[model samples]
Target: MKHLPTSVKCVALLAAALLPLAASQAHAATIHTQGSIQYVCSGVGQGSLQKMQAQAAKFNLGFWMVKGPQGEYLANVPVKVMQNGKTVAKFTAGGPLCYLKAPAGTYTIEGRHDGQLRTIQAQSGTTAHYLRW
Candidate 1:
């Protein structure tokens, strides 16, 4: 086989190293439309919610929402998870409840329902929030 020039070889190696990163980025979570907002939701049905609950226990962070008083599952509510004042994830409730995989730290979770805002604090072992309209 013929040897390539040093510069060409470096460029090829760089591209090879970055290919996986690019592919991963392409597959990263994406914004999805559920109801009134765009969000990256993870779980879908009852089975997914169960799986999320298990994962939440292991990952130390999870999020979900429900309607107030009657405690119905709230779907399609716009939710934003912020850590240290910077938004880490945005999701619209795909179901009456949704679970989020976030880092183990304090997060300010804001949910919008019927033009009203409901904010709450999330931390390890805290996953559920009640949102009112």
Candidate 2:
């Protein structure tokens, strides 16, 4: 029988003992390929607001909008998720806000704000921004 030296035997035992620790340590996880989209519409008068909102909806994304003092506004629109050219989810964008978290896909999103339409394509967990002129 071939015999290992005392030091080699000890090292082998230590390596075996540490194997589980190494695997457990490797269990720490990270998020990769996760993405988001944000919208910032800043301009004077209603033109910018209208254009920005119109563009946001044109893409069919989900977002939140809050009317601010002196005609200022804040909104967050997420890209719409769709399958076979149909809208799976809809977002209500305006004061008294709401939010939706959808799985990744393409979609058509439309909303009515002040007699205008906002429609666009939305994807999974994507953030889309718009600015008014």
Please give the TM-score that candidate 1 achieves against the real structure. Answer: 0.56
Winner by lDDT: 1
Report the lDDT of model 2 for residue 111: 51
Per-residue lDDT tens digits for candidate 2, residues 32-92, read 1213423232332434445444444423334433333443453433323235675454433
Which stretches in model 1 have alpha-carbon errors above 4 Å? 1-48
lDDT by residue for model 1 over 23-125, one digit each (tens)? 7555333434433323344444635555444445434444556666766666778778777898777766666544455555787879998888988887755
Which parts of model 2 are misplaced by more than 4 Å? 1-71, 74-83, 94-98, 130-133
The numbered model that scores best in TM-score is 1
